[model samples]
Target: MNSFGQAVDASNLDKDVKSTTLHSVGDAAPDFSCRTTDSREFKLSAQMGRVVLLYFFSSSNPACFAQMKYLENEVFQKLRRRDDFQMIALGRGHAREELVQIGGEHRLTFPLAADPKQEIYTRYFSKYVPRIVVLRWDGSIAYQASGADYEGVLRLQEVLARELAAARTR
Candidate 1:
């Protein structure tokens, strides 16, 4: 720790230790594999050529529902039509059946993935719900945030639009 009370640089720490830290803007997103609520396999490595947006939330939370609604109305509607982009809503602390039910209830257009074990959630973020991680085509993070309030979602919408445009041009 320094006199300013900040921990010293950890760049030289073990890779595993570094990975546990919150992912920053330019960090390469950790690759993960999981089954979508639709029963299809999703491998992060396979998405290397496309932009990816990973939305982490609890299926039972109303705030998460609001976040999804904003994403559905403003973000997904536009991004879903693109060929070079994919958005997967990952449900933490929710069963596969619950995730499917929520998706059906919301008429969500994007795929919903289950993280009942919280493996994916713990790997990316330490706390907070409705977190969003936007990845570029090469797998580096373009944008990331822990909360999805109205303004935050709006900003995310803009970021997604800009990232999608950049991905298409690549």
Candidate 2:
């Protein structure tokens, strides 16, 4: 341990920093493959050339509903329009049946994935639930946060609207 009392454990840092000697805004997102709520598998490697938003969450979190509902309204609407981009909702916990029900109840249109073993979460490089990472067409991470921020959605909407439109043509 350091004199400042912060743990001296390098292993305690984010995976991105651990794997690579450097961190930058334009780094490619780590690849991941995991099952959706309905047991369909999603592979990040296969999603190259496509914009993907990786959202990690857990059921029973009080604030999760807000994030879910917000996506259903803001981000989902954008991502589902023509598949220029994809939003992969991954649940670190909660029953698959419950995920389906909650998703349907809210009219969430994007694909809802599940990770019983947290394999996907670990692969993506985060230490908490309710985290979000937005990736661009080339698999580079465009934005990320530890939790859902209404303002973040608004900003992303603005950026994605233009990008997705351009993507549709080319």
Candidate 3:
């Protein structure tokens, strides 16, 4: 049971939360499926042949909003045309309606997914929102960022470019 005033069930929490181990580079990313804001399903395994930049954020977070805007203006604008790469932003443990509203407000161009149960979030790490994870073509973790900092976001872009370039050779 967590001490945040909300009743918590031990069984409901992911094992990693108890172990306090968050996935890092070289680890295999756990596959997950979630409902997009457009009501379509998104499966991580389906994007195996392409490098993916997955952003986990919260709709209500200001830092998350800034990060999304930065991504839209800087990263997604440059990479949307490429076939070997894909970007997805998931609202960390949020509902579909909330996700759609957030996307609309931010004018996000990339696909947005809802994670009401935080299943995917917990799989990567039992941490707060505004996190980014880069996954290689074979589903291995390549990079991860826990905060919405310019340097981290920029570094993610660099790492992603390198990974995408390498994936094309295979």
TM-score of each: 0.83, 0.74, 0.85
Local accuracy of candidate 1 as per-residue lDDT tens digits, 1-170:
32112354645322433454488889899999999988899999899978899999885456788778877877778768777988899998878999888999988878888888899888887655767889998999998865445667777878877887888788
Off by over 4 Å in 2: 1-24, 162-170
Model 2: per-residue Cα lDDT over 47-124, one tens digit each:
776777777787656466788788777777755765567888888766577779878887887788767677767766
Instruction: Report backbone clashes per prediction.
Output: 0, 1, 0
Residues 1-170 of candidate 3 have per-residue lDDT tens digits of: 23212245645533423344377689988999877777778899999988999998886667778878989988899899998888899877788888778888879989998888888888877765677889998989998766566678779878988999889998
Compared with the true structure, all predictions reach lDDT values of: 0.79, 0.68, 0.79
Which model, 2 or 3, shows the larger lDDT?
A: 3
Q: What TM-score quantifies how close candidate 2 is to the native fold?
A: 0.74
- Quantify how close model 2 is to the true structure by its C-alpha RMSD in Å: 6.3
Q: Please give the lDDT score at residue 55 for candidate 3.
A: 91
* Number of the candidate with higher lDDT, 1 or 2: 1
